[model samples]
Target chain A: MAPNGVNGSSGSHRFDPDFTRLVVENMGPNVAPRTRQLLGGLIRHIHDFAREVELTNDEWMAGVHFINSIGQCSTSIRNEAHRVSDILGLESLVDEIAHKLVVEGDVEPTSSSILGPFWSPNAPFRDLGSSIIQDPNPKGRVALMHGTITDLLTGKPIPGAVFDIWQASANGKYDFQDPENQTPNNLRGKFRADENGKYWFYCYHPTAYSLPTDGPAYKLLQLMERHPMRPAHIHIMVTHPDYRGCTTQLYPKDDPWLATDTVFAVKNDLVVDFKPKEGDPKATLDLEYNVILPPKDYKGKL
Target chain B: MAPNGVNGSSGSHRFDPDFTRLVVENMGPNVAPRTRQLLGGLIRHIHDFAREVELTNDEWMAGVHFINSIGQCSTSIRNEAHRVSDILGLESLVDEIAHKLVVEGDVEPTSSSILGPFWSPNAPFRDLGSSIIQDPNPKGRVALMHGTITDLLTGKPIPGAVFDIWQASANGKYDFQDPENQTPNNLRGKFRADENGKYWFYCYHPTAYSLPTDGPAYKLLQLMERHPMRPAHIHIMVTHPDYRGCTTQLYPKDDPWLATDTVFAVKNDLVVDFKPKEGDPKATLDLEYNVILPPKDYKGKL
Candidate 1:
């Protein structure tokens, strides 16, 4: 009876009247009626899952051990476990699926995936056109990315849309997760769009690389017979007060790993070519992008 | 995807590649090939159940809140929450269904029901035949309880079976939970059988009563149109090295609530009768009794 107990039909053998009793009794005194109903549904779903699997003692123990390992692997600077959660897409699934159900105008704050073990909350904010080089890894061809944020309905520019961007170094290492990376804020910065809702940043082209293989997600990838490679890209979270936030990635043309990215994060709209400009180096670096934002009235957040 | 990602099929859409990705990414590392097969089967069952119910968003949130409330309500002194769990019968269902899967020679400890909120872990032990009347109230007819513990298979007396027993006071109140009744530890005691596995105790008849209606279980009862009555009984936990430990209740005949106990704890084999001795008040104080334990080879203890 996985968390969506209503539709779940299996696990009836294991579904004692007690499941309902435990849920309701333990719900405590202060819970709202709506919350209680929600919880009861969830218990059914979780129980259904357990029943569907006819979960064995050994398997249950393994799950406990797995969760314990996730905690153990989390550290001050690295949260391999969190990245594993994100790569699995639970954060996005929960956020998007839940958001889709919410009605207009009363949406909760959208919580984007916080990729674990590979991000720093305190990365420095830099102005547009500033370089995002951290340390001495061989830099690739420079890319100048320009983009506009506009309302999806009116096409009106949304000035001050904040862009929080990060990318792996040339060696596929993040500053906080990799001690060998020397840049204090390697390849990570926050920028606000100008009055015209346009902004640009300068950074070396990223190279496709595999996620760290030493962590739990890597081990899971191997067990699933899946690859761990992500297409070369820059991660971005775009936000404005009157618009829904977007967490996305931009991949370059013809990356070998694009089609089979381990995270399933590649969408058609996010793939763009860095069409090289002719002759002058400055011309060669230019890139222009336009992103349509969900309007204020849409109000789908989670 | 309650806990195990089992709800993929619950939605109107069939599982897409995204679902497969979720399966591969969320399953833990080191999951054996066989385990994956088993998990796959389970997930299908879970998804089926979800679709059957067409569970809604608000319902799912209710379920989540319900689980969270269980954690919040749990504490050392009282597990009224567990009472609710027991009423649901999930506790017993899980115990009975899982019991058979236990491998020989690898039995775990006697997995008790969710510890009810009233246990103190420090009940005082008393001698055989001692009365539990520190402060008797609304006394009923006196009954002499005598019992000899013996192996079910060999019919040999177990010399040192320990008996921990508790019951509501004559007026149907347990000391700990009944604030209006008495102080703590009043109607509970532990005793050991003699070499012949014989013991006796003087106590008044117990009356069936309802569980607390001031909590969420009560609200649930209202929602489900159910009552909160239990059969008149005494709870007993018996333990010996040669056999499995058993926690059961001794019910009195002709009790109105026997068949419809809120907790669903009654078993025909556990019923008992109290014979009234009608001679001199002190004469024939001793009564003969016998308890057939489970088979000696029963592998339920650690």
Candidate 2:
């Protein structure tokens, strides 16, 4: 017979509903309301998912290991896990999904994405018509980019909008993540548009690059037998206190991997032509970027 | 109009199904069959969970942070995150539910709980008739414990089983984690049963204690509004060269926390009575214990 405990408190082994009750009864007494709500929703979702999958022990442990490696691979130069997020298109889908909600500026679309592992606090400021490129060591043809940022409805430029841009060099490397390159900042700079919402910059045509395939995310990809390439693009973060902040990338027209960018950041409104200037002594390019400010007196914002 | 890329690649962004596809596809390469199967299944479960909850960006980031704190909370004496697991009952549920499926052998009829963060590898081995207590602290009335390891089918006692027992003092502190009290080996030991499947030891009755709540797990629980207490119990890791391994615990009968053990470790067959025996020399002692052996022909198989 199964052993019995004092006062007959222990009897047949049975599933206690206590687990569910305990969890609900014990979480978050001091958290902010929004955070509490978010955590509560997350716990519910995770629990429901576990139930739906009937996840096993080994499988759960594997998730633990995968997450562990994500932590290990997070360095100043690389965030392999974030790269995985990009490859999965989580960053693009959640942050860059343009909708009526965003265009109407019902919610302030703060720049959101993986905060890619390579970002640093040191970004030198440049003028409206300044060249961001320093030491043009493996330089390609120079291109001049111009854009007019205006209120979507009024077609008026939101002068003085700060435009931050960075891109892969012709050799497919960002200045921060690559250590072999010089340190003073290359292919990355911040620019301000003039009062007319007009601006231009001198930089080489960006090239396509492969996401890092040497870390745990790579191990994961190898385990799944998948590719690790992203389309050619220039990374940009557009921000101002008044208008919604936008973190996006502009994809080049002729990159072979455009359709398969590991981060899935290509957005139609964001992509612009990097036209080749014909013997005009200058590579002139022009595009219009509109910013829609949040409406006055509206409170339910993102 | 939605702008198009020069190469005519559609830049229109939407939440693509390809995101989920890429996540599963890029996990790990050529792992063990069992590992691959497990990770693959888990990835699917996490994905489904995220979708079912319509997981938002903010919520997902919270999960990442929660996990990060869990890792941060891990130390030599505390692992509150695991306690969070215990409080959620995931630890006990997993231990009891899926352990056999992954590795099967001598199944212990008793209930098992989490391996709390305090167990140390330096426990001093004690002989059969010795007290587990070395320090004069957390005193409780000593009582003799006796039992026979018999087969449920045959009702025959099995001899030569080794039973390892460890528990906190009456004050709820394990020796190693408590620096204010005493030296290394205190209130902890291991005992082996004789040919009759019988053994005894010395120690006061274990008392319930709150789990470590000063770390990140505590912060999480505070956020979750939960307590950090576990019911009184004695851990038993029973093994014999020929019998199946059983790592379990015996909880006290009248524990107030029985219904609410933070780690969800209460099992039905695992509870044992601490009867107050009639006035005898053994009854006045500081500690007393007993043991039972495994079945014959039960070679230790993992």
Q: Pick the candidate with the highest DockQ.
A: 2
C-alpha TM-scores of all predictions: 0.58, 0.74
lDDT of 2 at B249: 76
By TM-score, who's the top model here?
Answer: 2
Over B1-302, each residue of candidate 1 has an lDDT whose tens digit, in order, gives 33333344434442233554354445556678676755554445433333334444444434434433343444455354455555654444444445432433432333233223344466678888787556667555556677888765566788888877777787777887676776676777777889998877766567788877765566555554457887888766777877676665677877987766676566565667766587636322333446656554765432
Fill in the DockQ of model 2. Answer: 0.19
State the local distance difference test value for candidate 1: 0.60
The local lDDT score (0 to 100) that residue B72 gets in candidate 1 is 40
Tens digits of lDDT, candidate 1, A139-196: 6567788888887656678899988788887777777656766567888888899999
Name model 1 segments beyond 4 Å from true.
A1-18, A76-81, A98-125, A134-136, A139-141, A156-160, A178-180, A192-197, A208-230, A256-262, A276-288, A299-302, B1-8, B13-34, B37-93, B100-302
Give the DockQ (2 decimals) of all models: 0.10, 0.19
